[model samples]
Target: MTTRHPNAGLERLHRETGWTLRQLAQEINRLGTERGTPVAYQKPSVHQWLNGQLPKESVRPLIIEAFSRKLLRPVTYGEAGFPEPAEESKNPPATVEGLMELGRQDMDPSRRSVLGAGLFSVALTVPGWQDVVGRMEAIKQNPKLRIGQAEVRAVLAMTERLSDLDDDFGGRYARPMAAAFLVNTVSPYLKAESSSETRNSMLSAAAFLCYLTGWMAVDEGAHGRAQQYYVRALELAGASGDHNTYCHVLRGMSVQAANLGHGAPAVRLANAAAEAAPESTPRMRAFMAGQQAHAYALAGERTNARTALREAERAVNQAESQLGTFGGFSSATLAYSTAEVRYALGDTLGSIQSLQDHFRLRDSTDMQRSKLIFSSLLAERQLQVGHLEEACATWNSVLDEYPAIHSGRIDEQMAKIASLLSSYQRNPIARQTSERSRELCLK
Candidate 1:
């Protein structure tokens, strides 16, 4: 076995710093709580390192860089991580050259050379993902071209490939890159008159892209900024009457708000998604219900939470109980996770049970990032309940997947873990989980 770092290189991240597993876990759990997530357990510093399980695919990079900051040196993809730029090296490749080249004057020759290679790889593969500069230019071009089916297909295909361009690159690649495509390639078309299909397509693409931008912001620890983007995306998505996207945007908002501690708002937003997206397919309906249930959990309405959760589970079951093309909303776990909102609401024991329920129903490996995120949270919950040895063993086992999970929110949690470690007297685990993380910074 590769004997992955249990969590990429995060397992050893704060090791040299001397923090304990319990302390780490406390800090990690505090992160979700601080963010307004219903979860309230503040895992100890030691648990930060010992917690088992890793982030799922959608959130691997986010988890990795968060802990990365504590290390004396940054870790990218392969060695330590996949690859990093000499300057802003860990940024996604497609946008690396432009993103890093803006201000880099000096860097190691060998590192620079390796970064150059990584950049090339990211660009050709993950071109759909890039930053949001020159956005107005897209509008200036042909607004008539927005979301042409041909273009949507091309960009989406590219996005799928870029999604796999490896963890050395960040998540901004997809969100910003797609946003640029919409603004530059598709937005002008909004000014044109066309079939409902074209308009819907354009709006769908733009809304999702905008959501990605906001999501990237959230991932990078800019919750307020992400909120703005999410709100805008929701409006745009609703404008096009694309309920799927509308629901997804609402879900995103709920995520940010829940983290910010606005349980009522989260619940309201989620409920709106469920109601507005009534015409949604089973998969989409389940997901919408799930988002709502998650909000209910945040609000501490266990009965309501369970009720909505059951509805979501019904949707997921109805979706999976069949065997046909679910048309872009076939993900069963989306709804199942919603049903388990109690976990995020800091119902660790509840979450563990819900997770088990979710695990039973979750049959898709396509969501590696989601699994990691939920799993990491559950492990922290276990640690908070006095499972110190279990926490350490957990971190030792499942943290290797950290490299692939991308989200900046994870960094905030890791910082909290580092803070907790500093309080330890002489615990090596705390030290290890609390070290300074490396970065592909512009300096």
Candidate 2:
């Protein structure tokens, strides 16, 4: 008979959690449901896992995530007595090859669900600028294929068009197209022969596209997949020695963390972005500082958050009008960031006021998707403050535009509309809005 010893690492973590076997099993099962791969794990499964019984491959991540959430820290596989995943154990692939694989997976409809199932890890190891700078794998360039400034320009133009699509419509439809482009066109261009300047420009363009794709993924709530794309963006940006794009990608990651309410990681990433910025213009300073303020607020650093917000305001004041600034940090954007910071700090009424200011500053150039999202947020806050009639009016406007936009974040907001207004159904406007929300959800 084989002697099966207990898993000491798992045992230690379990003890630290102070959870009974049943509680641990329940938490894992809950997380599984959240990931859309529901499992009926019970106490027996937990006991077996603790007693040297290896779990099925898919269940391992759920276990780790459950521990991470409960402990409020990253719990690695090693700490949970699991072997490192095969992909992690292997030598990392070349940037181009890796990007192709990721993009291809994203492009395939059947594979997208699996990709979305990837769990967001608080402990994801992000590469430093020094580590990745100029570190792209040597391409075995085909002498027959040469790209120049024109090709780089084409990539940039295509990315701009995609951004427009993402803005008007939403990421759910736009992301697949972006992924296909990355795999089909961008990957080959990366591997093609070009002058050093042309090559670096192409690299920077590709990095921006990757960042946009990741931003779309975040819109669709595929956070883990988004993080993967963001990392690739960072690697490409660093390889091109594009300090601006590198910092921009870091700020995007901070936004992702903040949206998911992972405050510590958000603060860390936002601060990293600000710290790594190179010769930043005033607009860029506002962009970085605005995100820093949001992140610091989320992390409960009131003093730091206030200081960052003031710096962002100062930078915005100093910035001159420029076309095509990265992420467009304008007065409107600042107002939105202020709202976010206020909300994070429990200033609900102040947040609503800031959001109103955001709309007042908005112009025709603002994204339709963003308009709906901010409107929905404004309505939610209005409802929280007992302005039921005002909230209903705002939601009606959101519903009017909702059918045209396909975004996971927007869908989430729509889902909340019914629940939030359920208690106020006695009010006629709330009743109508709730019914309309349900109809949209059904569609």
Candidate 3:
């Protein structure tokens, strides 16, 4: 996804650091071995990375990981000449699952083997990906408009599209297209201007990307990497001077932290999000408060958690009232976020009821698959309370759709369903459901 010449800074940095690609790779190998996460690097592959040439997209993260470990401080993508968001909102709708798809594809060592995998967003509404590439080429032709804020915004919008929509109606086609526009076209924009506003907006964009990447790490059970990303994202959000975006990133961090059982920081982070973004649009406010409730629930502060949930509900109601006549997410996404908290807090009934309310507000098919995960999680809570027959039935009902939706979030939910059914795998109905889930869902 890097757009600058593959060796954007390779030639400069490799010499300055006095480390050959092979030397760095060896250091990486040694570091990983010492840490007990040994990685084998091909010498030729190391040479290719040094000279850029894209260095195989699969090796991008390895390079990042190796450098981050060596630096002993955070090494943001922007600093590495990797494409960073220069303009756009940080929280793309499919941000959670999209990054995992990125990492999954990156697992392959072969360049072509790493197919287009991480794509979602409404940004695909743009013209063809080739059109975008052409546009980037044209930017090179124009001296005045090349780095203009308008062009930067255009690129940011395209990135958003790649992370939102999941219509099997060719979503894979959109991934590389958007990545191309960002890397080849937009990344140069980051270097165009270091003006205060541009810098702030770029930071906001970078933070959002971090949030997406962190969310992906969470799906893979990589807790420490996920936490580090969240912390850096939070800092970037602060640097951007945007309370709304910062809160959103923090809200995401709360979910990750809570899922990893870091109850206290989770609670604190979500609470700060809610507090700082108090004047945010009603939907945004609900998202923050919902995050607060989730963190409190994980912390076992039932009384406080319940109160925050009520506040979240109040925020949702206020949001709906304001957008009473309209059907658009800019107003309704907060309630969907709130529903997720309901499930997180063990409110299965509430989650189901809220989701039912949300079923009609969508303009994208991506939410259809998302709704299934919410339903599955609700069933999980049902099983927790001894509603085995209903839970088995509920999990089975959605099994029909599981195989087709490859989002990693669905993977986690399916794994949970599988675990829940394990207790009753011997039962006839349970056996059928477990096999269906395993056979259909575990890719």
Candidate 4:
């Protein structure tokens, strides 16, 4: 029933290993077991691969190892008939290659390699910042490809547009296009020769894209892929000596950790980000401190949460007074932090008030995802306080935006709201709203 094509590359590699198909399969299976994922890949499976069948992405790493051990040399995934992963290194060219590979894989929605390898190791999140930072390389005087200011400017422009799209439409709409641009356009520039200035600019641009890609991955519910992107982005940021972007990437990691309920680790990452930020920007300081506040709240450290919240507010006020530039540290940023702090302290009314302030301060043209999230939280809080009519009303606001955006986080929120409303199914308003929420989820 299967069409077979000659996989000459794989057949050639197997021949070089001096092992028959059976022996190779045995070695692969052993490696898989050692890695705690037992696989029974047999000789037939090896034959099938040689006949052009691709194994699961997770199995590719094990196969690479099997070839490495048998061949007595470092075997890349490509050498073992698998696609290359996003590679990282102190070397800029190598890092670019990794980013390109990531982009290439992401461009194909059907490819499960990156998405399926969702290995979120909370253990690996710690213990690399110092080494990574220390190993940051200086901009190369001579790059492989000749790059110029024009190319760099183009990449930056694309990044800005993609960022805006991400804010408005969520990651699902823009992530594939971003991935394509990174690989098809940006990677070539990174691979080309360039002057030191051009190289630094290019590295910074690539780093920004990587960070955005990771954030998009988070929105896609692919936490493992997001972690990989964050780590590589941090490396690129450090190598470019871009402290501001470096701190931002760290803050992203902290946010992801907090979302995963590893509150202590999240707080630690946020603290590190705050420590690493440029002193000239109070807005950055406030954002990092606010992240720490949110992490503390997640950890149920009421005192620490309040303390960090106060610090965040003070820094935000200072930033505003001094006219510091804003990125993610806009007015909505502070209000969101305040809401988290208040909710942690059991001040439901205060939390609601802060959330309303967030809505008032956030630009209407900004990301609809944020609006959906804030509205969902507001409705949940209102429902909790026995304000049934207001809760239903608040949820209706979310429905207004729900059909327009595609976000895993938003979908999860809608599902939660639907589940909560089930208890109120006897009420006509609750039943109607619950049905609408379910319809959105199905879509």
Candidate 5:
């Protein structure tokens, strides 16, 4: 028989944890339960893990959490004896090159492992974010082609176009086109730079497209890929001395973390954005404050959440007097943030009202998918509060709109509604909505 030795990585961590195998297993089970997974492993599972056997994929997160709790720091899958994840590039040239290559790899089906290799690592991305801002310097003049402002504007235009497509059709369709653009057009311009000023503009434009691509990844339900793209965007933004974009990207990271139910890291990233952009415009401050409020709400910090929400509203009011258009956060987005905070704080009626207000204020053409999602949230909250008939009416208003938007998030919301309605499936209203939801999902 071939002998299986103990896994050195597991053994080292186990020793550092200073716990017996049975104790470790008990802790893992407890951690899993806290995470809503109710694991029931004993000493045998820990022994098997120590004996060079990998646990189930779902168990990996639990293991990381258990160790993170014991070690009093974040623990990654690699550090906990799992396979190493693909590392993101740390510098501008490498990041640009990686983004170009990622675009190509994303297009090739045979290279799907490039997209699927690892889970998102907060430890890798978050700690490094603090060192990126204010470190921007002039780019070295690596003149290859005669690039100018027009070329940079072209990229920005394409980014805006793709953003529209994403708003309508979702990221699964836009991601490939965005990737191709980066690989073919943006990559050459990034390599074939111009004067320092032009290069900065070019880099900033590239970073924004990268941020868009990252947002698309999130839309398509690839959180790890999204994190890598956000990291690269941060690097490019820093290289361009665009601290506003840097803070914006950090806010994006917080949104991703919150979506993944990672509250603490979400709060950390949101707070970092607010602190890093002390001189940011009021509109930008409103955006950051909204993010902070969302993260605080997710973490169950009710006082902090309400405080941030008030700050967000005040910043938006302050922004009304500022010069130039506030392109990012509007009153509708603020309402969305308010809804999230209210829902988290157990104000279901308030959440539903806020969402309804947002829907009334938001132009559906601007964000069809988001509108659909908020509508779903409204319906779900209405159902939670025993307003079944109103919930059904809220759901019926968008039955036609559901079939057009190609978003994993939208799909998730529909599935959740279906699941929630399953209990009331015998009711005529619930039955009709359930049937329609099933049809939309199948389409």
Candidate 6:
């Protein structure tokens, strides 16, 4: 008879979770449902796995994610006594090739669900500027294939169009198109022979596109997939030696972490971004500081958060115009950031006031998708403050625009409307709003 050894690594992680076998199994099953692959695992199944029985291949990621969530850190396959997934390579591919592969996967509808199921890792290794600067892999030039400033300009223009689309609609419909563009059009441009200046411009443009794609993924609630795109953006920005874009991508990563409620990582990424661009313009300063304020608040650093908010206010005050602003950082954007910081710091009333200010400062050019998101947030806060009528009215406004947009984030917000108003169904407006929300969700 063969002796089967216990999985010491898995056993160690299980102990760290402080969960009973039943609890561990339940958590894994819960995560499976979240990933759209429901499973029914019991204590016996978990016990069997710990006692030298390997889990099915498909269940391994769920186990890893469950531990990562419970322990508030990433748990690798090896750390959990599982073999690495076959698709993961020990030797990372060159930047362009890796980007192509990622884009292709994103473009394929059949692969998207599986790709989106990737777990967001709190302990992801982010490469610093020094590590990736000017590190693009050498490519064999095809003498006939040459790109110049015009090609770079075209890419930038295309990206701008995509951004407008994302703003008007949502990322759910726009992201596939972006992935296709990255794979079919942008990838070739990256490999084409060009002058150093033109090449750098193309790289910077591509990095921005990647950042936008990641931003869209976040809107779709595909956080893990979003992080992958963000990392690629950072790598490309660093490779091009574009300090501004590199800092911008870092700030974006901070936003992702903050949205996911990973406060420490958010603060770290925000600080890194600000530190990298000490000599940035006033608008850029406001952009970075506002995010820092929100992150610090999320991390429970009230003093630092207040100081950063004040700095952001001053920087925005000093800026002459919003023309060519990085990420459209304006007074309105500052107001929104203020709202975020206030909410994170437990000032619900102050956050609501700030959000109102955000809407007031908006122009006709503001993205409809943003308007919907902010409106939903305002309504949720209104309900929190015991203003049932006001909240319903605000939510009604959101529902007015809800049908036209396709966003996972918006869908999540819509999903909350019914549950939030369910208790107040005796109130006519609340009941009406709940019914409407349910109707929309069904569609």
Candidate no. 3 TM-score: 0.57
* lDDT (Cα, tens digit) per residue for candidate 6, span 154-199: 9999999999899988998799999999999998999888999999
- Per-residue lDDT for 231-257 in model 2, tens only? 999999999999999999999999899
lDDT of 3 by residue, 316-388 (tens): 6777554432212232454555565666666767766566556556456445555676667657767776778
Candidate with more favorable, higher lDDT: 2 or 6? 2
Candidate 2: give the clashing pairs.
Answer: none
- TM-score, candidate 4, is 0.75
Cα lDDT of all candidates, in order?
A: 0.49, 0.91, 0.55, 0.77, 0.79, 0.90
Worst 10 residues of 2 by lDDT: 1-10
| Global Cα RMSD, each model | 16.9, 2.0, 13.5, 10.8, 4.9, 2.3
lDDT winner among the candidates?
Answer: 2
Candidate 6 TM-score over all chains jointly: 0.93
Q: Give one clash count per candidate, in the order shown.
A: 106, 0, 12, 7, 0, 0
Spell out the clash pairs found in candidate 5.
none
lDDT of 5 by residue, 239-356 (tens): 7778777878888899988876667778989998888874667788798899999999988888999999999999888777434643378788889999988888889999988998
Candidate 2: segments with Cα more than 4 A from true spot = 1-3, 18-23, 42-44, 322-324
Clashes of 6: 0
List ranges where model 3 is wrong by over 4 Å.
Answer: 1-146, 165-186, 194-203, 220-223, 227-232, 235-239, 278-281, 320-366, 416-419, 423-427, 441-443
What tens-digit string does per-residue lDDT give for candidate 4 at 267-329? Answer: 778888878777546776788889999988877888888788888888778765434364557
Expressed as tens digits, the lDDT of each residue in 129-196 for candidate 1 is 11221221112333444344676566456545544431234443344454454454444545445566
Question: Candidate 5: deviation at residue 345, Å?
Answer: 1.5
Name the candidate, 1 or 4, with the larger lDDT value.
4
Using TM-score as the measure, the top candidate is 2
